[model samples]
Target: MSANEVFLVAMLIIFSLPWLVWRLCRTDYFAPLVVVQIVMGILLGPGVLGRWFPDYHAWVFAPPVVQALNGLALWAVMLFVMIAGTELDLGQAWRHRRESGITAGLALGVPLLLGCAAAGVLLHLPGWVGEAAQGWQFVLGIGMACAVTALPILILLMEKLQLLRQPLGQRILRYASLDDIAVWGLLALILMDWNRVGRQALFLAGFALAAWGFRRLMVRLPEADRWHVALIWLALCGFTADWAGLHYMVGAFLAGAVLEAAWFDQARLDQLRHHVLLVLMPVFFLSTGLRTGWSVGGGEVFAAAALLLGATVAGKLLGVHLAGRVLGWPACEAPIIGWLLQTKALIMIIFANILLDRQIITSASFTALLLMAVASTMLTTPMVAPRLANRRAP
Candidate 1:
């Protein structure tokens, strides 16, 4: 078969298999279709399919087909990340400064510290640290991954739990919003290239000017025209950022960050995000799965995954509990908030992908983190259901 035909087969497998499993098994209560797709991606990856059915895997995922899929995945994820950025409610967070600041600080900081300690340990071992990474870079990268709350996934889960529009949900969103900014800022720091420092500085300066002009122009344009302009802007920023040594995904985020979400209709924006997830993001997930490896050994990879999950879960609970104590919240609230905040899915994976791309972490390390993200995300709906039910019981 031609490469295009084979690529279509790959896409058919990617889209249909996970959806069929999710629907047939009714796994929505525990693992969403998105999570299922991620797992399927790993199963289809070289470590599994290629190891078992080498010829079939190779035939289907030929170089040209894989490259085409990757191109699709890249843009899908870039748009997804941009939407995530545009949804940030920094102004709302500022209005509720005291509560948001305290919670966001502890939630991000505690996990980061604990994850750093775990990274420090992993550095002593084989196949954990990337060859290109400085000791500190690897540690900080892993730490931030632990600290990340997948805001998009969190939003989805909250909507499922019927908390999305509630006061508690709004409060949680504020905290997550602040932390999202921090997560990306740290990513920029970790990915900084000393050799390209001048280029990066130039990019930032140019971005500042362009952003100001863009915002001014957006205000003057009709709302219907703004969407097209934003897409053009997204492509431009992504190109410039990549040219300047920062990843295009970082550029994608900045493209959305500079724009005001209020300028867009909330319902339309929500639908766009949903459509992106439903259609394109699964390709991104499959692409991510293709990157997974267990070269360090399956047992070792699983062990690392378990350890990181423990650190992330424990640190989130401890951090939120600390915040509850500091703010004198009802004692019962901490566990619920902690579990909700511990949800890690798309954002953490995206973060790790950047690290992997930059060679800040080895494939073994990426595999471990990928497993940790899936497990933690799967834990969310099951863990939160009972607490939410109890809260509703007058």
Candidate 2:
């Protein structure tokens, strides 16, 4: 087959298979289409498809095809991350500062400590830490991965659960928004290249000045022009950050973070997000899947995934429950919030992807983190639905 034909074949598989499984199997109750796409990506990856059908896998995912897909995935994820950042309501968080601070703090901190301990255990073993990573970087990266809350995914889940506009849902958003900031902040720290520190510093200084000018210009332009300018901003920031060795994803997040959400029409912004997910993000998922490997042994990878999953679940619940006590919330509220906040699909995978790209974690470790993310996301709806149902039973 021609290279273009093979690439089309790969694209067909990426989009069609996941939808078929998601729609035909009625998995939405437990696993949404996005989650299924992720799982399908894993199933189609080298560990599964390549193992089961080597020649076919190689032919379909040829170097040129894979390269084309990667280019799409990179831009897709950058747009998605920028949208996530633009939606961050830091002002809302500030309005509820005391509660937001305490909840976000514990929500992120507890899992971080537990995940660090889990990484520490992996450190004693072989094939977990990447070649380029120091012990601290490996441990801290894993810790933050476990602690992450996929704010975008969380919003989707809440919307599905019919709680998005509810008071509780808004509160959850506030907490998740603050954690999103910290998660990216930590990622920047982890990706810091001491050798390129001067470049990074200059990037930051230049970005600050540019961002101020950008904001001034944005408010004056019509909303239609803002969208176009935002993309230009995204491209420039992504390029500069990658050049500075901070990773383009960090810059992508910053590009959106500085822009006020109110500047754009909410409905249009939401539609753009929906369209991106529908059109582009499936490619990103498949690319992520292609990167998964079990070189450390499948059993070992699964074990690590299970360990991270346990720490993530337990720590999130513990932290939220502690917050409930301090805030004098009702007993039932903690579990629902905890379960919802623990959703970790796209953001965690993105976090782990950056780690793997920089060799801060091995493919074996990335595989494990990927598994943990899928499990955590799948658990969110099942765990929260019952609690919500019971609460509304009376």
Candidate 3:
């Protein structure tokens, strides 16, 4: 077959199989279609499908086909991250500064501390840390991974629960928004290259100037024109960030972060996000799955996943409960908030992908983190639905 033919076939399999399974199994109550696609990616990866059906795997995911899919995945994730950045309502967060700050801080901090402790334990065991990792890089990377809340996924869950536009849902977004800032800031710190420090500094300075001028230009343009201009700006920022030895994803986030969300129509923006998720992100999920490894043993990877899941879930609940006490929130609020914030499917996976790309974490560690993310995401709706059903809204 021609490469294009094979690539099309592969793409067909990528999109069809997940939807088929998701439809047949009816897993939406627990595992959303997105989560199922991620799981399907893992099953189709080298660790599972390749091991069992090596010849078929090799034929379907041939080098050229994989490369084609990777290009799609790269652009998909870049746009997804940019949209995530654009959605950051820091103005809303700032309006509720005290409540937002306290919740966001504790929600992020407690997991970080516990996750660091878990990292310390993992360090003692070989094959869990990456070859290029420094003691601090591995420790901090894993810690932040645990602390991450998948903002995109959180928004989806809230929409599913019919609380998306409610005051409660808006409040959750505020907390997640603040933590999103912290997550990216820490990632920048972790990814800092001493040898390329000058370039990094130049990138930041250049970005600031470009962002200011771009914002001015965006404000002047009509909304329709703004969309095209934003894509152009996304490419520029991504290219510059990659040139500076920071990741393109970071640059994509910055590109959107500097702009006002008010510049775009909210309904249209939401539709764009849904379209991206439906059409592009499954390829990203497949590419992510292709990277999963079991070199350290499946049992060990799963064991580590369980440990990290416990740390993440427990830490989030404990932290949010404490925040509730400090902020004088209603009694019914914290549990729902904690369970909702524990959604870590997409953003955590993105964070881990960057870590793996930087060689700060090995494939084994990435696999473990991937499992934890999947489990935590699966737990969110089932756990929160029951709690929210029982409790009265504040």
- By lDDT, who's the top model here? 2
lDDT (10s digit) by residue, model 2, range 36-120: 9999999999999999999999999999999999999999999999999999999899999999999999999999999999999
- Which residue pairs does candidate 3 place in steric collision? none
- Give the residue spans of candidate 2 off by over 4 A: none
- Candidate 1 local lDDT, 33-100, one digit each (tens): 88999999989998899899999998988889889989999999999889999989998999989999
Q: Per-model C-alpha lDDT, please?
A: 0.93, 0.96, 0.93
Task: Give lDDT for model 2.
Answer: 0.96
Q: Candidate 1, clashing residue pairs?
A: none
Per-model TM-score, in order, reads: 0.99, 0.99, 0.99
In model 3, the Cα lDDT at residue 179 comes to 96
Ranking by lDDT: 2, 3, 1
